[model samples]
Target: MMNIKNYKEVSSLWIEYKSGLKYYILKKIKNEDLADELSHEVLMKIYKSCCSGNEIKNIRSWMYQIAHNTVIDHLKKENKFADEVTEILGVDKNNTYEDVEEFVEPLIKLLPEKYSAPLILSDIKGINQIEVSKKMNLSLTATKSRIQRARKLLKEKIIECSNLEINAKGNPISIEIKADCEPLQKNSRKNN
Candidate 1:
């Protein structure tokens, strides 16, 4: 167990994991400013828990779990649940998709703008499809079509770039990125 009673220890922990925690939150929310704020909130939660004498068996995992839960709560508040993506990918909601969620934003970024814009506006931004259509100055049908095409393209890209392990119910249990996956590599580089 780690002792976090000392302020220096907690500060060191935050300094070490701050960037990684913000990146993790950014991947889920696709917003840099919000990710930073949420990461700070996560740090406070961790400090409070540790100060309360909680025994954290694995500090890294425990910190990330708090970060993940914080991101989920933020998404819930923004009405941006991953339900649409889960439905598009045929993944069961009951099975946690935390393993796969990190790849989603990168995959979406790999799509062509014609296909990706509608998806970003509607899905990631949590705007209604009708509002997205108007914002993009496209007919509702056209916006919907683009979003659907984007989903199909994203699914195909995921399959081409990774080896997915699916459960008996056809939900992706895990994903292993292929060694030569250039799109994901480029996306990661762009972010850095």
Candidate 2:
């Protein structure tokens, strides 16, 4: 039921898609290594789905959906990897910046699909918010709201991280201070 000609055509199409996907994903991810890694994931999923005869009638739409999900999943996996890496690096989990940035990455994965694009485009790339809105075919207000929420979330994460560090230090100080008072009480007992 399969033709060699059709397979060859699909292979060529996949190659073309890969180049575009690399640049597109790279722009959004901000890290060369990460974009390359996620692009590889997107390509693999597309190739596998197409070969499996998944009835993808709209190739563009189907490919975009797959790429989007692949990127989100990649983000989640990267966050986990970062956390593990921080631990392996002997960074203190309770008062470390390592897990803070890494943990926030996965939260971006939770943003609405509609918001993800504009936020990544405008915030990550320093593109004008209005320009990103036009590119996404979204209203300027919606684009601004997404960016605002993203900033707010990051701010909260930083504050939470600072609080964690402070709390971790607080317990140790309280214990040390209590221990210091015990020595003073022992000296008073001797004087008595």
Candidate 3:
């Protein structure tokens, strides 16, 4: 636990808070160094906000709100160079060696944009649900629904991807997932 009263404790809490933030960002961003940089950006802003004499009511939530903005800011910055992100998204920019990037790229494609936004923002970026709601400009309940839908989609996609990988391996895994996703499969690949 961290308190506002103790500077060292606050700083320690800041570091811990940041690791989780970085995890979230890394999941969606799919780049460790980029995610770490974004996490640092959020924490630095929080520190500066404190130094600027803004009264934070709930330190944890307040920090997350800032994290949300940092993510939004990062997105906005990316948006300024729209062609770049679009290209980045479409490409398999897996530098060095990591299966996570290869696997996640396909999974990301399976998710709907709206559902993906909240899901990625909350689950991947480690932003709080409330902060995600705010970022998506959705009511909290709506955000919950989007997240649930995203999970459903992600589960379905992963299972599908797994089956594909297995089938490729000439393994004898049951093909039940294909039958289960029959209706979803019709439009699953279509980006809505």
Tens-digit lDDT track of model 2 for 1-192: 232234565677677677766665665466899878888788777556555643433354345445555655665666757554334334222212333344344445445666566767876677998899888887889889888887776555434333222222231110001223343334335545
Give candidate 3's error at residue 109 in angstroms: 37
* Candidate 1 weakest ten by summed lDDT: 87-96
* Residue-level lDDT for 169 in candidate 2: 28
TM-score for each of the candidates: 0.48, 0.36, 0.37
**Using TM-score as the measure, what is the rank order of every candidate, best first?**
1, 3, 2
User: Which candidate do you rate higher for TM-score, 1 or 3?
Assistant: 1
TM-score winner between candidates 2 and 3: 3
Better of 1 and 3 by lDDT: 1
Candidate 3 — worst ten consecutive residues by lDDT sum?
Answer: 91-100
lDDT of the candidates, in the order given: 0.74, 0.54, 0.60
Better of 2 and 3 by lDDT: 3
> Model 2: clashing residue pairs?
none
Q: What is the lDDT of candidate 2?
A: 0.54
* Top-scoring candidate (TM-score): 1
